[model samples]
Target: MIKDIDKSDVIGPKSIDSPFLGSIPVERLSGGVKTLILMNNDSEHIFNASACGDNCAKWILKIAEKKDLIIRLGYLMDFGKDEFDIEIVNIGKTVHNSLELAETVLDNHLI
Candidate 1:
């Protein structure tokens, strides 16, 4: 039996299978939208995800939960061919902080 999943679990059985691990292309579209492209080797059913962009993690998680989105905790290649390591929760908080700071600065200047 596996360490976490029970014997009757459907992860490795016929229901769910992962022949290719970490082989999906995640694209960060504008307006905090993201899409996961499945690999040919993948079963076309199972996938994964980590985040969308700087502050889109929370929304991503929410939408994913309802739509049964597949999350891939892997890497993403941007248009500029850059790579980054990030989390959705932290990014959301950071963006919120930045917006708050900007608002405060604008208010002070107007006063």
Candidate 2:
């Protein structure tokens, strides 16, 4: 139910449509800001998610090239604190670091 993904969880081996973000691990996407979550059926697990942008997603794509990308995360506030915001994070200095950074920000919300 939206929360289940964790900082330590592996998000992908990637798909032709969805891909992984290097060693940090993540699921890839296409357009507008989206909410991604990891969940289980027992109702005991949860992973916080964020509304992420295209550029941010591209940063996630970068991880494919570099696994050593360390990350720092930020948030795109939407209409104050009422509406959830888009999260921004650096996967490293390169590309896919976005995913890792995003993961870190989201992970901060849960496991």
Q: Which candidate achieves the best TM-score against the true structure? A: 1
Task: Estimate, for each residue in 1-111, the C-alpha lDDT of model 2 and write its tens digit.
Answer: 111222133344542222233343234332121232221112243323233433343433333134322222245212221222233333222222435544554665522
How many times do residue backbones clash in model 2?
A: 14
TM-score of each: 0.25, 0.20
- In model 2, state the lDDT of residue 53: 38
> What C-alpha RMSD separates each model from the true structure?
15.3, 15.8
- The residue-level lDDT of candidate 2 at 107 comes to 62
Which whole-number lDDT from 0 to 100 does residue 1 have in model 1?
Answer: 15
What does candidate 1's lDDT look like per residue over 1-111, in tens digits? 111221122343223222333222222122233233231223456444433343444444345444544445443312121322222332232212434434543444522
Best by lDDT: 1
The parts of candidate 2 lying over 4 Å away from their true place are 1-53, 76-111
Off by over 4 Å in 1: 1-51, 75-111
